[model samples]
Target: MIEKTRGIFLHAVKYSETSLIASIYTEHYGRQSFIINGVHGKNSTVRAAVFQPLYLLDLEIYYKAGREIHRIKNARITYPYSTIPFDIRKSTQVLFLAEVLYKCLREEETNIELFDFLYHSLTLLDLTEAGISNFHIWFLFKLTRFLGFSPSREDAERCNFFDLQTARFVSHEPLHSQFTDKHLTVLFTRLFTIDSSSIENLDYTQHERRLVLEKLLEFYHIHLGNLGEFKSLEVLKEVLK
Candidate 1:
C-alpha cells in the first residue's frame, strides 16, 4: 500500500551507475531504504538535491511490512534549507548530525516525537544564523530522551562523574574511565541551556570542544554497543577548527 510521510534523508549511496539507495527516516514509518533510479540522467538536479543527506522531504512511499526494502513513489522538498549547505560551518554541522544519526538510531518503532524533534532541530539550525559550534553537543543530549536514557538534572548535578557503562552519573569512577566532571558540566551547564545565539558567549577553546565531543562519542560507544568509527569526525573537527 502507499502512504504519505515527511522524511529526513539520512544517507544515500550510489547503488548503480544511474540509481541510488537512500536511507530516509520518516515520521510515519521509521528508517526506510529506497531505491531511486535514473538519478544520473541529464537535468536530474531536482531529484538529486532532494535526496541529499539530511534534506527535509515530503514523500509518498510504497510500503510493505516485513519487506527488507521499500520504494518512494513521489518525493519533494518539504523545506529547502537557506544556508545549511552554503555555509561551511552549517554544512559540517549537518554532516556531524547525519553521521551520528546513521550510527546511533536503529529501532524502527514508531516515534513521531523523535521525528519532530529532529526535523525541528534541523530547521532551527538552518534558520538560526549562529550558535552552532556547540550544536552536536546539544543534539546528542536531546537524543537521549528518545533512546529511553535521558539523564536527570538532579543526578547530573549531584554526581561527580558520568558513568558511560550505565548511561548516567555516578559518585565514583566505574571500572573504566568513561567521563569526567569537566565534560559533564559542559553537557549540563552549557548545552542544556544555551542556543545558537548564546553559543558564542559560552565558548570554550576549540581543543576543549573537540576533547569533550570525542569523550561523548566514547560514552556513546560504550553504552550503545560497538558503533565503531566515525570517518566524518576528523574532517568535521578540522573544519570547525
Candidate 2:
C-alpha cells in the first residue's frame, strides 16, 4: 500500500545511468532507503534534485510490513532553502552534518522528539547568520540526550572533569582520560545553558570551536562503537581555517 509521509533527505547514490537510490529519514517510517527512477531525463532531473542533504520533502511511498527498502511513488520539496546551496560555508557545514547524521542515525523506529529536534536544527542552520560556526558541537551534545548518554551537570561547580569513556562528569581526571580540563570546561559550560535561541552570536574563535568539536568527536568515538573518523572532518577544518 502507498503511505504518505514527510521526510528529510539524508543522502543519495547514483544507482545507474538513469536512476538513483536515496536514504531518507521519514516522519513515520524512520530511516528508509528508496529508489527514484527515470531521474536522468532532463526535465525530471530537476525534480530529483530535491533529494539533497537537509531537503524537507513530502512523499507518497510504498510500504511493506517487514521489508527494508521501499519504493517512492511521488516526492516534492516541502521547502526550498534560500541560502544553503549558495553559501560555501553553509554548504560545507551541511555536508558534514549530513554525513554525521547518516552515520549516527540508524533506527527503523519512529521518534517524534528526535525528528522534531533535527527538523528545527536544520532550519535554524539555513536561517541563521554566518557566525554560527559552533553548531556542530551543540548538535553532538543535543544528540547525546536523545541517545540516552547525556552527562549529568548536577554539580557543575565541583565536577572538574568529564569522563568520556564512562559518559559522566567526574571530580577529577580519570586514569584513562579522553578530554582535558579545558576541553571539559568548554563542554560543561555549553551543556549547562546552551540552546539555539541563546546561541545567535559567537564569542569563541573559529579555531577554538574546531578544536572543541574534534575533541567531542573523539569522545564520541570512545563511547559509540564502530564510529570511524568523520570523512568530512579535514575539509571542514580547512574551510574554517
The estimated TM-scores of all candidates read 0.90, 0.92
User: Cα lDDT of model 1 overall?
Assistant: 0.77
lDDT of each: 0.77, 0.78
Q: Per-residue error at 13 for model 2, in Å? A: 1.9
lDDT of 2 by residue, 68-170 (tens): 7788888999877888898777788888888888877788889888888988888888898755676667777788887767766766656777777776667
Off by over 4 Å in 2: 42-46
Error in Å for residue 186 of model 1: 5.4
Q: Tell me the tens digit of each residue's lDDT in model 1 across 42-143.
A: 855337768777999999878998776787777899999999989888898888779889887777667999999999889888887655776777777778
Clashes in predicted model 2 = 0
Instruction: Give the Å shift of residue 183 in candidate 1.
Output: 6.2
